[model samples]
Target: MQKLIFSFLMALASLSAPLQASEPASTHANITQEVNDWLNTSLSNSPGAFSFELRPIVSRLKLDGCTQREISLPQGNRLVGNTMLRVKCIEGANWMFNLPVKISIQVQYAVAARPLAANQEISTGDIAMQQGDLATLPGSVILDPATAIGRALNSPVAAGQTLRQEQLRTAMAISQNQKVKIIFRQDGIEISNEGIAMNAAAEGQPVRVRLDKGKTITGTAQLGGIVDVGP
Candidate 1:
């Protein structure tokens, strides 16, 4: 009877030994498995369409200020045949805790972004324009910032570019004093007159020329205010 009781006790201990030995490792494995599942699901099932860019396997991970743990196979666990997928879990916190967590991962992806072109004419909205009566100003177009009005959107206008109203505006024409010669012809005599410029002119413009001798002549010429005439 004594020998039989001792044998039964030994058998119980033998069974208990394996469980004790595996308890810690099994707990860790559970945690690892759980986390792995979370990641896999996010990669496959999420409606946001996530992609798994597998990075180099990190050897260890820490959770919530805890010591980092390594993932490995169970000691007595063995596979019958060779398999491509090797799933391992870490031993942690008493229970077989396997849970996956999302981590910030860096990946390379292609995206479309706007780029400024060379020689593109910039629009008025692109620049700041002052609000005031432009006619009252010396020039037709008065820029609010002054510097922003006329600027190149891109370097030079490309060959196939269509000019847009936003990209361009009528430049303010300025007036300046100029000297012009006034000629008077009476019968067979010709008289020449010279005077200071009164105002600025535009290209292909016509202006009235006033002579010093109280005479005025109306003529059309390329307007630049400054004109050349013979002696």
Candidate 2:
């Protein structure tokens, strides 16, 4: 009696071993085949030229970190992998489709913040306008060149248009300088300061001088060289 009972128990144990071991592999194989079939069907039925690619499906399986592979559907098309297949059509297709998309994504968790939330975009720049006094702040997004110039006096600045600091400073300085007439007399020849000097003078160089409305008179003078005229 004891020997017969032992033999029966051993046979039961042997039967249970194969069933347990085969469960997971059978499940995985079934899932893989189903997904492949669904994708193949969708690709064939797609209207016009269509493309698709497999994306890694990331989700928790039971208590373990499971990698569920999926495809990143082109355009707004809907596609999902579950026991029951999910599919839907989209307005237009933009990206191409690739196959199998070997599932390699690890399950991730959401903590303090949802790290997987849609990406946040950064703004480049904006335009604004000012309406009040020159001292008051402008209330518009589009910025004017004049206002920008005032703010950029001492700092490095880049704007919608490229203006060289050296060139701009030179032009502004020339605009601010007082108009003066330069005149020179060499023997019988008489020449005005404007005729003699194409560029503004150095601090100590002597340039022929005359007032804009005055006579042609030769004087030792400097160009941009500041001179205290009149007592």
- TM-score of each prediction: 0.22, 0.24
| lDDT per residue (tens digit) for residues 1-231 in model 2 | 999999999999999988666423213343446566666765564322333344432332221212343433455433322112332212222222233342111211111111111112111221222232211212232223343232112223333322223312211111123465444455666554442322343344343444456543334444353322221
Error of 1 at 195 (Å): 45
lDDT (Cα, tens digit) per residue for candidate 1, span 78-181: 21111112233333342122222223322222111223255333444443323322222222232332333344442334432333334443322323446765
Model 1 residue runs over 4 Å out of place are 1-5, 11-24, 27-33, 41-48, 53-231
Q: How displaced is residue 183 in candidate 2, in Å?
A: 99
Against the hidden true structure, what lDDT does model 1 obtain? Answer: 0.40
How many backbone overlaps does candidate 2 show?
18
In angstroms, give how far residue 92 of model 2 lies from its true place.
Answer: 38
Angstrom error at residue 175, model 2: 67
TM-score (C-alpha, index-matched) for candidate 1: 0.22
